[model samples]
Target: MCRNFVILLFFHICGCKELFDFRDKNKGSNCDVVFLSDSVKNGTITSPLYPSPYPARTICRYEFQGRGKERVQTIFQEFNLYHPRDDNRECDNQDTLIAFVQIEGRMEKIDTFCGSTLPRPVMSNGPRLKLEFHAVYGSRYSRGFKATFSFIQNFGIKVGVQLPDYPCAFVFNSNETRSGHFYSPNYPGFYPRDTECYYFFHGNQGEKIHLHFNYFDVEGVFPCEAKSASDYVEFSNFVSQDRKYERHCGQLGEFDIESDRRFFRVTFKSNDRLDGTGFNATYQFLDKVESFTTRSELTNETAVLKDIDGFITILFFLMIKLIR
Candidate 1:
């Protein structure tokens, strides 16, 4: 019994030693940098010494790759990096987190982030996304940042019609569905600066496209100052070069519109400067004859119901008089 107790105590001591050592490593020195795998549906990226003041002169790179039509999205849950002392709301490169997105084989979309305000969620336009975190030597090291990333599927049909050479352009046709919804790029979040996106809608013959915007908050003035450099949304019924379009901007909460023909187009343009949470809209293809015919029938039925009510009221009064 004495020998057995000695063996059990030795094993317990060894186990406790290993556990404490592992935790010590995780406390500060363990820079939790995890690379994404094809099988990984979601994961996290954190700075070295995360939750603790990160060490200076450290750099971490995270790459995300998705398959087929899947895209990458990331939301920063905790962000506290050192920025310039002037508090201008822009990072001076002392410590920063930068994102590079590859869209349509183009790397034109690059964003830089720093400071303590949590960043808006980011969605890559394509399957490839790269992130770099930098902490300059001898710079202030804060608690660092933690972000969660996942692979998500994009919306809209991608067949038949020719895709635009630019990013954020989509085509929708009635053949796929009679009704659908679309949102501004990075919607519910402030859109990127100096960006333009196009949405094309096609309907079958005898059908008109009806678009209803549930939310609209593009940054600009009402009627949109011509060439004054502000964000605005345009609606067009024609696809030709000289086709006329109506432009609107400012905080118009909700509105509805209908196309004069079977095709329609929407263009969202944003310039460098103030930005706003974009818009969300739904569209449907309505048969002109069926829609108007139903309305006409409903109107006639309402008139008949009114006449019947008046006749019943008159008959009730006459019966009361006879009883009296």
Candidate 2:
């Protein structure tokens, strides 16, 4: 009889499919802001070569689902600011303020929303800035689904002095040399031979500027060659005889830097030789960066060990049999 009752309850719940459906809909539409940074606090802004000297107070907020059965897990992340020195700085306009966010554990659904654009204007008399992201869901039985989002923000300003400009060049050498070639299937073509990319920002002489580098990889290749902490790097600034300040260098992997100059260059050199065969090295941008935090709560409802009516009925039958 107890088994029969349990079966009945299960069917009853299955029949009321709208119950879970309605619950899911309600939960999806709801947004719970889980974290808020104080209007004023000190934090560091990190980049490739330069680290911002002064800490600036930046505000952040996040929203998540709050409902029944289907638990909602929301994560909050903050990134160091990419503060450009001045309004006319070319580097400021070119560099992207990219950040990453991740969610871990069983997630029935997920979403992320971003504001229309970066340097999202600060509200008058308000210290906090707002950003939005949409939700993305994970597959069933996939308890932990991690996701990351990255974007660029431009701060219209050049905060430092303009340095002398330098001429930048890129030379590609393979077992074969072809003009106007985009990609190569050979060894030297695959691996970076030197750093030769550069960016220039407008500023005065002797002024200081900060550069930050955040690296990531998507191919799951560990110890891959690119712009990262392991590599030995250097930066310089100068003005050109043409009166235009420029930054220049050899071939370097994917990276971003902030400096005061009109001309810039990056040089790239491979650390080890690649096999002459196979497509081993492919030029690509680093993966997005991300971080996360989680919280969980249990409901007040308690589970019943057994049906009270069924227990009593069984006990009565057993007592009668014993008397007989």
Candidate 3:
């Protein structure tokens, strides 16, 4: 009995030690960073030594991954970083706080901030958000920052698009194969500054995604300022970062896009200024590949084409003859 008790206690100690090992991986000497894979509706993020000057040579990244069509939003409860100059990443400047999205399976920075000026509430675009904090060795570190964030469910409302949920990139899986509509975060409302939103659409088997743009208005000129340039909308058949099939900006009338594959994506980004009413759009499943027309209808169309071709040929010959 005594021997059995010793073995049991040993096993328990081993188990506890393993648990601590896992936690230590998530711990830094003076940084707190995490990759939240689960759905987190509410939480707080703060520097490791918050309320005091953070340690020099520190780096942290917090990535929040939304569940399904959900997006994340964050409000800065407190922010104070050392920004001696306006430039944040000049090396030997000041501490820097940055926001990024997973593009092409890599972290692509979308915005950066420094200084005592607190940033406006920012949201992610798509299901994934990557936040970075670098306490470079520089002047005395300022008081670290504190923030609270939450997840928002986007069920595709039509009335108006809002931006609180720029915690973005709506992703649809095989389970959500039915027809649907996707509006901007707040359709009729003014979007927030430095906002990014992503929408991942996966079509059902044997079908492609069809989209109709009821309204599209954003800042900047067309083509040049659209897409990844400034405040614009982008569409991609594949879900890689910065890989765009078509990018759109400016006020648009009725327009439609048909996907060639079962996977597609759309993203909307707003800079710090000049936001508009945003966009309202709808999506449906289409099967152009497997579709067929009646035989008689096909024959009729072919005959019409032949007749037009013959008439055009004759007209061309007559004009040539007249010239001769």
Candidate 4:
């Protein structure tokens, strides 16, 4: 009986260890940076990228926006990387790794669209990354009117490694707005939609970094009562040097608005030569005016005139009319 009890205790300890190990692996890390609506009034940063000690092959996950019963479709129209290294093989396959749905444009002629990242080369076998999506509805609606959606952005790495210290990462910043004709048949009119971008870096304590930007507006129509716009920007970073991976997602949002024309900006400066960066800006305009014209006036600049001698002719026509 004594031997059996001892054996049972040994097994119990082993089981507890296994449980703890699994829990640790799945546990979410405390976000080093988080930017959401209603938080920042306005601001900017010099260098958006932060440092991380994890191998260059770490994978990160980010979730941006969701939909409810209202039947509004959220679309990611464009994705761009700035100063990206041509040597980065991962970026070369952006079309395959980053997925998006084009609502109304050159790509397709659909009212609604949805897509996901396709299969790609894995860079590392380290900690897997997942993204969860959430959405909030307006108060004017009834029960079940407001809802939140959740999804995971998974990152797979081929090569694995044991880190001596947690890795550091950087968050990109952006600002955008949606204003134009509401293509929705449910609600029609001109409403304004705006968004701000920010980022969080989570890894080793010393490796984390945070960057933020203010909100901006676009001249177009947006859904009504859609307060606080938010979404996640997901991507895979492949380290070709060591054949590793670093997937990342930095939560970003815009909450406070104190002006009429909303505009936001992001800046980055780095001494490290390896630090790569760039940005993409897009603007869509609808033609509503019937007549448009422009003229240039001469100030302190020299003016040149040409004289032409020809049969000068002036014609004027007048007709006599009696008041009726």
RMSD each, Å: 12.0, 32.9, 16.5, 24.2
The CA lDDT at 298 in model 3 is 86
List, residue by residue over 126-163, the lDDT tens digit for candidate 1. 67777877777323457889998877653222332435
Question: What TM-score against the true fold does each predicted structure earn?
Answer: 0.55, 0.18, 0.45, 0.18
Segments of candidate 3 deviating more than 4 angstroms: 1-32, 35-39, 86-92, 138-141, 155-217, 222-324
Residue by residue across 1-324, what tens digits does model 2's lDDT show?
Answer: 332221111112211111111122112221212222222122222221122211112122232222221111112233223323335333333223322222232221112222212231111001122223222221122121122211111111121222234222232222122111111111221222111222333223333233333231122122333543222223454522232322222333444343343222222222221211111121111112211111211121212234666788899999999999
Best by TM-score: 1
Candidate 1 global Cα RMSD: 12.0
lDDT string, candidate 4, 216-243, tens digits: 2222123211232222122111111111
- Error at 136, model 4, angstroms: 35
Clash list (residue pairs), candidate 1: none
Worst 10 residues of 3 by lDDT: 14-23
Total clashing pairs for each candidate: 0, 77, 23, 34
